[model samples]
Target: MRISVLCDVKPLLGEGPVWDVRAERLWFIDSLGRRIYRCTADGAEMRAWTVPHAIGSMALRDGGGAIVALQDGFHAIDFETGELTHLVDPEPDKPNNRLNDGKVDARGRFLCGSMDTGESDPTGALWRLDPDMSLHRLDDGIICSNGPCWSPDAATLYFADSFTGEISTYDYDIATGAVADRRTFAVLPKDRGGAPDGATVDAEGYVWSACVFDGRIHRFAPDGSVDRVIEMPVCKITSLNFGGPNLETLFVTSMAEPPLPKYPGDGPQRGATFRVEGLGVTGRPEPYFAG
Candidate 1:
């Protein structure tokens, strides 16, 4: 596979790369930078807007604009007016927790999780925002949440809690938006030097996960066996997604500033977004948040 820098602009904490099928564009977030960016499939015509608070993740809306999981809660973004309207805060009681990684399900429900700002306490929970704008809690007691994706049939949900070193799967009920039968799907031991970060599933049902400190991207079979591993040039690879006209290109995001004390030696391309091609695999179009 061929991998190269997608753009020159680097973000302090780049995460959440999403491909807009309708717009044929790539959208991502600079979490610590408090900025949202969009660019053409070829990494041109890039545009950005700043948010009032730090954003963890975002998804395009079917109607228009987008929905963002900010430090406070979920907000609706008006691209035309640059207005951010607060929708709801699932965990107003826990001021120390902030919303983190999220993805839209096949039925158009937005699923996101929260994480402790200090990254020490398990004060976070996974939440779902339905099309009606109502919120539902799925799981709790998470230290850091990342990587929420679904299987090909939408019957299984895969998620990761970074501090736990395990990626878990749940039996997902698409019609009711409920998750059960939570079980370990994969594991990245602490000795391996990385934890699971962001992830996406391919059209063939294989899951691709980014190893944050390990500088590698792993492809896992449906049985949770490691199929292949691609080492990255940068050290702190944060997230990745499949984009491009036919969804053949893999777009990756990374972290730069506030370097981890344990994992040092970040290269010059530490925070740059990367474009990977020739993977010989394609991805399904991510669904727009119906809300």
Candidate 2:
């Protein structure tokens, strides 16, 4: 499958593409530019919200507001009024740390991770929130945490440290918030280039991973094998989703940084959203915090 940019958001980093099923819209974040955006599914009406500071990820809440993992702390973003309310900041004194990637699990609890803002230190971790409003730090010493997506059967969990080039799988016990039997699902091979950015699972139990340097996305099987690859024109493919009526169109998000010279048909394609004709199974909708 050929992946291309379907829409554009200019920033040092663009991340988090969550699909809002109720509103039929796609909400994502431009990390360093300090903005949150809501766009129509067709890549029109791109509206942005200027955060007081940078935000790593944002998702819908069970109540009325949005939950954002910000550089300063975890903020409750009021959807109606656009006000940011502080909720929590686990590491308030760690000025070099910031929240990175996150997603809501099947049980409606938000799972997120953090990494060093300096981009060198490994003082990061994975966190979990219980449905009963309890919180726990799941892991430690992580760098550039990415996807925390669950399998279609809900028995496995996949997470990535973008800087470390490791995607690990765990035997997930959702009821108890426990992960054991850890194994390397895919190493990503740092020598081959590209880090695993944002990732999701299709109904077929394939992990669709976005790449940072290789201008493509990878589809990895449940048994830890490369099933296929989707190439893109832009080098930084940050996030993606399976949207549209049939949920077969793979919606991709990209940035404008090109490692090489621009080609002829590269005007609006770079930093723009792109969709392939036929891809993905009957996939699950991207979840939100709903907390």
**After superposing candidate 2, which stretches have Cα over 4 Å from the reference?**
1-4, 131-133, 257-270
- Model 1 Cα shift for residue 186 (angstroms): 0.5
Tens digit of lDDT per residue, candidate 2, span 18-91?
77776777787778778888887677888888888778887688665688888886788886788988878877
Off by over 4 Å in 1: 259-261
TM-score on alpha carbons, each prediction: 0.98, 0.90
Q: Can you give the lDDT of residue 114 in candidate 2?
A: 90
Q: Score each candidate by Cα lDDT.
A: 0.92, 0.76
Model 2 error, position 240 (Å): 1.8
To one decimal, what is the Cα RMSD in angstroms of model 1 from the true structure?
A: 1.1
So what's the TM-score on candidate 2? 0.90
